[model samples]
Target: MSTGDGVDEVAEFAALLTELKERTDRSYGSLARRLGMNTSTLHRYCAGEAVPQDFAPVERLAEFSGATPEERLELHRRWLRAVAVRQAARPRTATTTEPEAAVAEAVLPEAAVARTAEPEAPPAEAGRADAAEAAGADSGGEVGSGGGPARRWYRRRRTALLAAVTCALLATLGTLSALPADRSPSASSPWPSSSADTSGSAPARTTAPAAPRPSPTASPNRSSSPSPTPGGDSPTPRTPEPSTSGGTAPGDATVPLTWTADSQAWALGCGHDYVVAQPPARVPPPPAAQDAGPWAAAQGAVHGRETVVEITVQGRSTTAVVLTALRVRVTGRTDPAPGNVYAMDQGCGGSISPRHFAVDLDRDRPIARPVAGNDTGTPIPAVRMPYRVSSTDPEVLLVTARTQGCDCSWYLELDWSSEGRTGTVRVDDHGRPFRTRSIAGLPRYMYDTSARRWTPYQ
Candidate 1:
């Protein structure tokens, strides 16, 4: 081992792996699972054992580790060095009593190192060569000249370009799937095209917006409603009243309405079949789907990907609320949202074998994932609320209600994400996931008909 002039053979090898894991922000467990190896065994590999000659799992692990493009190439280089050393004969470094020497003793056991090479060459010598190469480089950023800022920037750009191309290919496939069953024009249809929004030439069909599910409400029958045709029957209590372009009320039109169980609330899953209204806080006024005044209008654009929808009731209504289901898309990336995508595998309340569901921030439905931090592995309880418009196209906030633990708090944005095509979840200072300073509303509580009780806190 040498000082500034040379790099320590053992230290450099270990540091490379450590940095790779850090930059990828991947857990050893996740890496192992992706590689189809026992998690404990994978941890041992990450601990600096030589890779087995069997490289299938290793290759896949490299793929999903979320490394930048440059990092992938580096991984390949490091792996090649590891294999080269495995094929060679290596001597065990001496264990010594001296403090500095003791530091050189690796906690990793030699037996764990993958022995893939012919025994003629020694691994110790191969490792020595690798170290010499690394130290000779001016910086750790580049392979030939040492990794410098310019080199690092070039590597990053290359990686991003590759990712963009990959995303584009996937998008093209997804675009095809987004289209309707048939491309034929129907006399009653307006938007004559799917995958494209050019429909001004289509027929004049009354397009109604989606209806929102209220939090908890005394209006027990509000969930379900019969679809209404404008010129038909007498006015009913729960018709889907549509707002005209001019915001004018209809005097001669009598709309027939009916209530049906809210399909949107049940979107959460079999058990969570309810919306974010967990227990209703305040009974909302009529038309929970109204555009309302200027307050409800969107102001600007968000950086990442996002989706917004509106709902309206045909008859008299006061309050407006939103229910959401959230999901993110960044191929090969794990959601930054905390708490494992809100899987209630055990069943909501207490049903056995309920269907698995997640909070897909990408959709206009109601489910959310809760997450914990590095120090705490326990996931937080969270759900998706309606995406509000304070700014334009913002990454939605996936709010979790931690009724207890770490003291009662209002909402935990375990992970806030947008649809910008960038798939990473961003965390802020304190290493805590991103959070907003003041969430809009106060805690509103209500009763759950299924639970037959009231939630204790917000």
Candidate 2:
């Protein structure tokens, strides 16, 4: 659009045409049909038999073919250059002896100057122009043009290992020139792409940008509407995509909402803030992270000291054993579950003892069948393991585990859903393990327990 751009859209248009033919394997007739134009028109353009008067169709077609805004602009500039050359080419004009030839010599590089010099242009120019216009088009790229953007990005991400290995080493090796947004010498005729990409490869043109055009086959109103390309007119995002392994907010319907018990919900990062799906959606009070004793535990039966557990074997064959203990009882009760009653203190509670427990399934199977360990009342932290059985309603239960490194209490809230049931365990809650992290292997794990040993289930 600027005067300094030199050539006009014609040259850029030519580049777009060439790029299209190369990028797609479609035959000429097929391409014409897609453009809603007659094959002969396409042939004339391809064969240099005729020049387009409107230029809209050619530009639009380029857009539909996924050409970028920069490319489109270059095509426009090249077109202008081509027209100026033609005017200069008028035979024996009063002042100009050969305008077209002169303009051609000025715009075209030394290599191509003599080759394309003529009163009439050739088809190959258009083809080459189209491809050249999109020098850095790639399907998955988010940036393009000069290397400024990429270089700045490298500076910011210098600490990132991937950035260092991908940019630093590549540049020192002289392979960086070919990396991201680099402009080729031949691309001077058109405005060079912006300097945003840094992948050390020309940023691939993303999806075609929006344009102002109407297709012959479509209604006038609809066809004439503008189309914008993906990342064409907008700035690229600075941050990397967040890790998929993290937890999602409650509103994500895709995620099974596992509501924590109001009393134990605080341990789930509820605090004073309403985080849990108390009313389901809208905004509910966050579950309380217990600050005092049993009443303020991370995750366990509200009043009782046991809970349910649904276990899914990871890499090895293992079973989830629900060990119950009565924490309120004076002494601890270490008893295995019959169906689902769990406890931490068998002798400590009213009629039971304060306790801790652990369990594992038969060693033969790597992953045990989906089983539900129902209410082994009050699954206390440091006393048992936590595992999930199903992901359907987003259930949560407390299970205990004995790790190789140490014995700690933590909670597990089913981040994802599968054929297995969901569960939550208390980590470092109350008299449990001293450390305070749960969702360990899950990365988002929050550890909340202290020094407490969970014996492996026999």
Candidate 3:
């Protein structure tokens, strides 16, 4: 209560807790609901009526309030002090019989011997018992003149308590010593599942990438023959569109290949299974083993995590189109692309799962468009195209989709022209395209399939 130079630690702690609750702007009911605890229980915590034995709820509440590191640390220290004080105030009672008997049996063989040899006293001894009581009354209830039994019992009990306390302290120190330095007890990391997302708000219109699913076979199957790889001759011909130029045409050799992208039109979902920079292995992790951070609000929006897509052109040519102008669309007019897949436990949960479509230069050929930001389970009505690069240039043409929010696996398709040659590369981003990007393309950091580990893309 004092406003003087000296601080009231208990009052200050209570005030801090109260301030944190107010800052969250959420009613006790809402907080309790999200945390799955009773409102009065949370109230008791904020009121400082009693310090909680477990700090899990406190850590969660701190995260919800978005408390800074310093404030969280201070609050934790306050709780520790309160718990220590409360524990110390409790009265201590010890039963001397058990410990004393054990010590006597171990250290004094004569004590056990005397117990076994004891028998009923004779009638004449009854007179001696009365006389012995009279002497004992004068000696203040001591068993013997020196009170050896009482002294021995007290000494043994004190020693046993001290030994137990020492063992507990040693065990605690040993456990702490084994933990990693960076992973010390703190507010930033309450547990493996309780890490906070400090990435902040991501660029608008980003979707949490889902676990890499099977490649769309619709597009590749439509073509009678296998689609030509990048830098190879295209079996299909380039059918030019009507020329807009007074003397030349839009699709003519004189005009460069053009494409457009409506970046804002693409909507990303908040709930995705995984977000890895590279393609996932053919044997995907089991449903239970998948990382589900995207579903957690505490981890923040999955769209916030950036996925980098890089595009590179190897052969130089004036006929090349703007790489960014291309849009993803279905390859066929009547073919249905793979529908938007929802992550496990995310059905109709307000996540706008993006639809996968084959990327092409043409915009109006039954392309799959992104669904409304609020809708879920909108069937992808277009073709799901695998990752591909098309170009005619003898030199290598490269394109990197340098964006974020890719799952542990994803898809990409690319088409381009160089050196008067048009070639197309089609493959799954989770497969060869993803591997080439790391092996021969650029140097970047990607999450490995291993649990909580990172590996270099070389």
- Highest TM-score against the true fold, candidate: 1
Ranking by lDDT: 3, 2, 1
Model 1: lDDT equals 0.31
Q: How do the residues 73-169 of candidate 1 rate in per-residue lDDT, one tens digit apiece?
A: 4444455445534433345455523322221212212322332122222465446545655765645543435653334444565466456545654
Which portions of model 2 miss their true places by more than 4 Å? 1-16, 87-192, 197-458
Model 3, 1-458: lDDT tens per residue?
12231124445555666666665444677568867789998887777666677767776666545454545656666654555444334543464354444433333344445543533344655456556667777878744445343344445655675576556546644543342221113244332232565357342221122222332552211111121122433344454332221112223332223221111111132222222233323223313312332232232222212222222222222222322223332222221111112122222244443233322222244222322212255342222221112233221122222222122223333444333333333333222222111111222233344563334433
- Clashing pairs counted in every model: 53, 153, 43
- Which lDDT values do the candidates have, in the order given? 0.31, 0.32, 0.37
What order do candidates take by TM-score, descending? 1, 3, 2
Candidate 1 TM-score, C-alpha based: 0.27
Return whichever of 1 and 2 wins on TM-score.
Answer: 1
Top lDDT: which candidate number?
A: 3
- For each candidate in turn, the TM-score is 0.27, 0.23, 0.25
